[model samples]
Target: MNENEAGERQIDIMVCGAGYVGLATAVAIKQARPSLDVVLADAAPDGVWKKDGRASAIAAAACAMLQRLGVWDELEEGAQPITEMIVTDSRASDPIRPVYLTFSGEVEPGQPFAHMLMNRDLNGALRRRCDELGIEIHQGTPIAGLDRSGACAVATAKDNRRFSARLVIAADGARSRLRDWAGIRTVSWQYGQSGIVCTVAHERPHNGRAEEHFLPAGPFATLPLPGNRSSIVWTERTADAERLVNSDPFLFETELETRFGRHLGAITVESKPRAWPLGLTLARAFVTHRLALAGDAAHGIHPIAGQGLNMGFKDVAALAEVIVEADRLGLDFGQEDVLEDYQRWRRFDTVRMGATTDILNRLFSNDIAPIRLIRDIGLGIVDRMPGLKRDFIAQAAGKGGPMPRLLRGEAI
Candidate 1:
């Protein structure tokens, strides 16, 4: 990076939002094309990332990308592979919730489809890799405004720091200020529900199995973590979710136990329960002029399929590949034409996943007998179809469609 006479920092690319997608994008590009100057600026205060206690399921393809970037080695010790998964649809009060679908096996020999790792661990590993690559991260440096009329997009920070770059990538999350400043509109809606996230320790081992119980409110997922701990994503109506998270400890645990079941033996809450409103936000246009959107800035889907983070990783992989390849060919990587390739590659898959999740959440988050019976029958049919199950596993593993080089475990 260089500074002009006006003291404005100039670079090849400026990535807003230092979360997983932004960090990975910077790392992947710099690792492949070291000549390009890349830097990250986040609105969050320094060290705030260390406080996130939530965990995410990293798909096989995402793991491959992280390994390629040389960050997975640091996270492997704490990662817990999800070897099996079962799905059931029933009311929370049902004494016996019959399993409607089951999924097992790996995408490749000995490689589970996904693994769970705490958000902090993932963020720390990526930040370390960024450090090793000489990438500068400016915490608490929120982009106050963006000017895209000039040859380079100039971002003005809240503190009046100016950053000029040929391309500006917004991974600033669902409610991205940069996205709006760029005049990008979004198609979105709320599900009238909020997801309650927390960690719990169980007396018995999970044996690497994950479970998703579709209750009247929404899907309650128990994702395995290292040892006898598991991360929970329980959805409830907005008011009830707010009450549950702020309720007394005893009351909260009692409500949690009602849906957690006895299969895991007694359970103890290990973290404070937090609630996040569930919604879908898809940007109307992913790229315009010198600016582009990635990760949650591009699309935010329901977490019913556990593919939220994985989708962001896919965006990083695709965007990085497109930028790297364009640069390799001696072309302007920030040109709208070049960025359109990325939009074309990711838009369909993203829309499909969004629609699928929306439909699933709507179909299962109810107790209507007819809808319940139809979905149960569909799940049962899917369970019995080996080929279909394999296809679903492949998709979840992030290996179904034409994969980007990084996702395929190859160098850009």
Candidate 2:
């Protein structure tokens, strides 16, 4: 580590975001290359992650990466495996929403394709592993400015403390200031829809089954959780979603019940419903100079496929692998040429997923008779093809492309 004349603290790497991707990246790299110094700085206050009641779908490959990072054991107990998934398309008022497609089976012999895990639990687990790896975490310290014109990138924190590192990573969020500061452009647009998220308790078991109902407004997904509770991602027009979430308790439950159905039995809202606007935000470039963007900083897509977080995990895996390998070869991993490998490996997949979710959202979130008929037929055909279903399950499990060491359950 080297310090400049201005008293800037220097480290090998500086990760600007304490979200899962940032935490996982720090842990993955530090665990593999202990000699390298790594630090994480977040804008949020300490313990703020505990209040996130939201949960995410962790694909099989992401699960393996977390396990390799020594964080999964802490999260495994609370995680709920998704044994089956069924998709249906119909109006909200439909009495019988027929299942047009169903997916089941495992990528491996015993491991299911995906699992549901609370965001807080996953973040806590990753944070704990970071502590074990001796990574310094600075909370409430946001990046105020970034200067990459020198030999090393200097990140100025909100508190005026400067951190000089060989490489700076931005994993902040979709609207990333670090990404902008680095002069990285993005292609983005709002979907005019918002996803209303909440947890619901039911009288009967969900049997580890996940359901995605394609209503006129958008997809309503109920992902199974521990016990008789399930997590809901109900999409609707922005105005309608805002009104529903802010409306009275009785009204929210009544509206939620209409789409949630009776299969799970008498359902009760267990958490405060929150609505998040849906959109697609993809960075034009994942890296520039000595800076690299990860997680939402790189791309944000619709939750129609439940691959948002999984895609971020893919960024963590690929970035960590590239950085670690480059360091092993005694090369400056922060160089643009080195970072380009990461961008190349991820850009196509990110764009593909973004385009796919966009098409699905547009194709399903409507009442057009001709489009509905065509989509239903497509779903029916896919349902009948066992080979095609297996391929989809594998893709959803994060097994579509070249496997990274961490994602394949191997140490970097």
Candidate 3:
């Protein structure tokens, strides 16, 4: 890694937080402009992502972007395709949970809407690409502060080391320190709910079908993983979530069985159950001065639609395009106009998705008879209308609206 010393440091871009978005952004930019100097840093030490047992749904468009970055071929086999999805609303003892809506997951020939893969696999691939691109990584280091008063932004590390760059990308998590340091405010709220995530081993295969059961408390999703295992995202009241997460294994499995059903035969938890607070967090502005926010730093929405990570990937694609173009044009990449282009391109989509997920969570997380009837009827209508369903499928596949060149598998 190149520190470049304090008074003479020169770098094109400095990306804070080595999470999925940070690494991807660094790799994408360096690959597009080999002469540019890029550096990625994270607070956590190296090999920390290996301990993350969670998985995510990578949408088709995100897959294409990864392929363009030379990371997808390594991820292809480790990913389990989601060929179909079914939604239902009912109680545990209702005899049957009527499927209100169903979707055929192909966005095109041989392309599925999404796939389930472990977080480590995705991060590892991006890290390898970063190495291949000669991008420097500052592991176990955090950007303590940013000094933007000079011609170039100077990021001061916790260890008192500094790196000067024309642009700074904050890919930190939802509670981003860089965002706060930049004087950026956010619109945020908690859902009074929590999502309990865990992986399960089953006797029978899920057959690439994902199921969502909207019970009184919240939505319960069984997403198909590779082999006869499936990943569970069960939403519940925050208090109840605490109890289940801290309860004995036997009690946990008992409650899980009630909602999981016997269709998959016997099921056992294969990983530790963890609960994450549900919420909506959107930055008031994505760019200010020479700094820009990406990933969860810009928006955090309920995972009901499973678009959180994919949306972050979209931000990566758009920001990379904007920055690369400005650099090639011999313009100031960190200028307000250049940064505004990225903000404009991504803000509308981010706001729309945050609102959509909020509405879905509110409409389905309760058991009011009247509201249930209305939503179920709405779902049925969507199911019966093939054209409407196709539109929705395309939207979920990240095929709707204007796409960045990287998302279309094109080089920036």
Candidate 4:
């Protein structure tokens, strides 16, 4: 650590952001090698992340990654497991898959394909764990700018105070000010649609099944929540979404019921509706000199695949492992070579997942007839072919792809 960034406090690493991605990165870094001094900063007061209506479906791989970082135990109770995944084309007359693809075993034996977790609950749990881990979390401090010099990176807060370090991790968010400060350009496009998310309480249990119902306007995904409540991701044209969200609760529930069907019984809105614009954004570069990017800071994708956070978790695991390994070899963890190792491992995969989600969202979340027929037939074909089903199961399990040990459920 440098003595001063022009006469200010110096730490080994100064993290910018305490969102899930930032916190995960901080915990992974600290857990990988506790000897390294690290600090996390965010403008949010005391790591508080307001609940915005929806929770993510954390892939088993992501759970393993958190486990490797020593944080999964804190998340277990709040997570709802997914035992089965049912995909349907609401346009088709016969929409149900002939056989439900069971990835329960493939996703991680005895665990569900993914665990649904409330955002604020998980964030609080992470904050508690960070506290236990001795991480210096500087809440209410936002980075105003940064300066990178020989063998060190320096960050300045809004008050003009600064800190120097051997490394800097920019996990701020999609609209990252840090990335901009680093002069790293990003490529992104508006999705022209918005995803309306909310929790619904119904008489029937969801039976641990996650359903993705493809509608004419978009895909209405009902992911299971604990007990009789289910989470809804209703995507539609931006105009339509705005109208529905502004509509009264009764009208909203009625619209939902008209689309949600009878499988889940009488549904009641449990929370206010929230809308998130769907889009894709990828950083032109994952690293610039001593600074590294992870999570939404590096890439943002459509949520149709439910892999947004999973992708970020992969980034956390990969970068943490690389830096930790370099430290074990008595090398500077923030050197260009080390940063490149992190980039090389993650860049291509990020691009592929980004493109895949974009295409999937465009294809299924529409009323295009030809594409609809192909997608429906493809689902049926995949259903009939057990070998293909196994392949997909393996893929969704987060296996047969490049992965970090942390994502494999092993400590670094």
Candidate 5:
């Protein structure tokens, strides 16, 4: 550890952003090598992230990683497993929406392929683990910029506090200041669509099923939560999204029920509706010198595939393995060659997932007659092939191909 002229603190590793990815990276590294110094810094004040009402689908591979990190058990009580997935294509007002493809959401006999996890619960559990692991956490300390000229990367907080570390992980989200400081370019574009997020309570139970109804505007996904509640990710044009989000409660609920079938019965909003503009953001490179990008800072894809966080978790796993093994072999963990290994390990998979989501969003978020006919036929064909469906379920679960040891629930 080193100190500046002002005597600010320095550490071996600094993780910028206490969100799931940042926390996971810190905890995974600390657990694998307990003696290494790790610090987590976030832009938000303490307890501010609890206000995030959104939830994400945790893939089976991510569940395994969390379990290995000693956080999943704390989240199990609030986590809702998705037992099945159904996809359909039709207009929002269509009386009959035909089911296209169906997937049984199970990786094994008793293990679910994924779970709908409230963001607060996930972050809370991770914070507790960080506390137990003795990983230093600095709330309200956003990385305003980064300097990588010396052996250690220096991070300057918005408050002007300086933290120098052998390596810096930028989990600072989609618009990353550290990424820009590192001179890493990105490939990005807006979809002109926004996702409306909210939680809803209904009279009938959802039976652990998830549905994706492809409307002309975009896909409307209803993911089952515990009890009679479900989380909705409703996509629409930006203007329509704003109108629905700001609509009166009665008007909003009426519109929601139109797309959400009557099977749930008497649905009411359990949380305030919020809209997020949709887009695709992929960093041109994952690493530069001693700095590395993870999670949203590295890639942000459409929510249509629900793989955004999973991809981040994959980064956490791969980066942790690379660093831990390199240290075990007495190599410079922050050197360009070592960091390049991580870049090569994750860049290809990230690009592939981003492309897949972009294509799916374009294909489903349209109403061209011939295009619809062809897509429906493709969906039907896939639905008929049980073997193909199994492969897709595994793919979505993040269980296919070569994975980092942590994702396989093994220690680094």
Candidate 6:
């Protein structure tokens, strides 16, 4: 409506792809700086996601991030806690090694490691917060074009609408078109495996225990959900995964049971099985002139560690804090000084997590005799060493890290 603002220069921040990171980033920034305008656009309908088909394991760290965003207090009782984790090398008929890790603590005096939440439920909660914060959302609109200069970045959506901003973050996803438009090259590779994710209802309760059964082909995991249901992440060879996903429910569940064993007792397919291709992707650089990459736009890693989403959340937290600080300091949020700081803060952590997950996948995705012996002993050693176990537990709880204030459940 104002020609001077658009024609001369404006400093609005546009977040493309209002999925997890996009929405999270938008709301985080709004909460941090109420005066700054944070806009999000996506190519889907805007709605509350109470019961979406997919579920993601939200780590304690991620939960803390949400709490800081003022979204956690609203999540329903659907967020299930994982009181225990059981890992086993499923090479032989019996477990070559079985390791159990337990944890019970709170963030303040009533917080607990993490919770199992439906993707929709979490998104729904964020959406409500966005509503309360007056965050602008442009849905059913995909960015179709872009124009950038030293002072401003412009985006053209599918609706033929033009939006301009001082900073534009690409949270679009692995096949991020925005990253491509920015001429940012990425290193990407397939894991030669695929993870089949689904929720199953079992005869016996999982007792809040999550299980990861590493076999020769790949890793199969069962994370506890509400009731007697468990979320399964079964990794398989690419070709086999395609076949299994295409197979009927009965056959698919049969194959799943074969690999899962009877640990959870008479398991029944409760939700439709889904297939996610395993892969690794790292953007050559995280920022361009006035643009920055967030979430999958920056990196994509194997979900074996359940750190993929958590990593994206970290990027969101860091980038939001950095930009908000720059605004308060009256500095150009997209200037090299700000962008460089973000790259430095995120690059190391992103690279380490990617490498760590890759190595873990390779090491445990097999049944090699030597590796089996070594890892089994390693597990037993950690099990016996309570101090070491506590460290591991804390790490898994997302306690020990370069945490932002929001991640620490503090107001930003």
Which window of ten consecutive residues has the lowest lDDT sum in model 2? 41-50
Q: Per-residue alpha-carbon lDDT of model 2 for 1-412, expressed as tens digits?
A: 4677889998999999999999999999999999999999873687899999999999999999999998888899999999999999999898999999999847878899999999999988988888889999999878899999999999998899999999999999988999988888999999999999999999999999999999999999999999999999999999999999999999999999999989878999999999999999999999999999999999999999999999999999999999999999999999999999999999999999999999999999999999999999999999999999989999999999898888999988
For all predicted structures, in order, the TM-scores are 0.98, 0.99, 0.98, 0.94, 0.98, 0.93
Q: Which regions in candidate 3 have their CA more than 4 angstroms from the true location?
A: 1-8
State in Å the error of residue 282, model 6: 1.2
Error of 3 at 146 (Å): 1.2
Candidate 5 versus truth, CA RMSD in Å, comes to 1.2
| Residue 344, candidate 4: C-alpha displacement in angstroms | 0.8
Candidate 4 has what TM-score? 0.94
Query: What lDDT, from 0 to 1, does candidate 1 have?
Result: 0.93
Prediction RMSDs, each to the true structure = 1.0, 0.9, 1.3, 2.4, 1.2, 2.3
> 2 or 5: which has the higher TM-score?
2
Poorest 10 consecutive residues by lDDT, candidate 1: 39-48
Number of the candidate with higher TM-score, 2 or 4:
2
Alpha-carbon runs more than 4 Å astray in model 1 = none
Local accuracy of candidate 4 as per-residue lDDT tens digits, 220-246: 888889999989999988988999999
1-412: candidate 3 lDDT, tens digit per residue: 4455455367889999999999999999999999999989763687788988999999899999999999999999999999999999998778888999999989888899999999999999999999999998998978888889988889888888788889999999999999999889999999999999999999998999999999988899999999999999999999999999999999999999999999999999999999999999999999988899999999999999999999999999999999999998999999878899999999999999999999999999888999999999999999999999989988888878999998998999
* Tens-digit lDDT track of model 5 for 1-412: 4677756567889999889999999999999999899999874687788999889999999999999999998899999999999999999888898999999989999899999999999998998899999998988767777889987888887888888889999998999988888899999999999999999999998899999999999999999999999999999999999999998999999999999989878898999999999999999999988989999999999999889999999999999999999999999899989999999999999999999999999999999999999999999999999999989999999998899998999889
Tell how far residue 313 is off in model 6, in angstroms.
Answer: 1.0
What are the Cα lDDT values of the candidates? 0.93, 0.93, 0.92, 0.82, 0.92, 0.80
Quote the positional error of residue 189 for candidate 1 in Å.
0.5
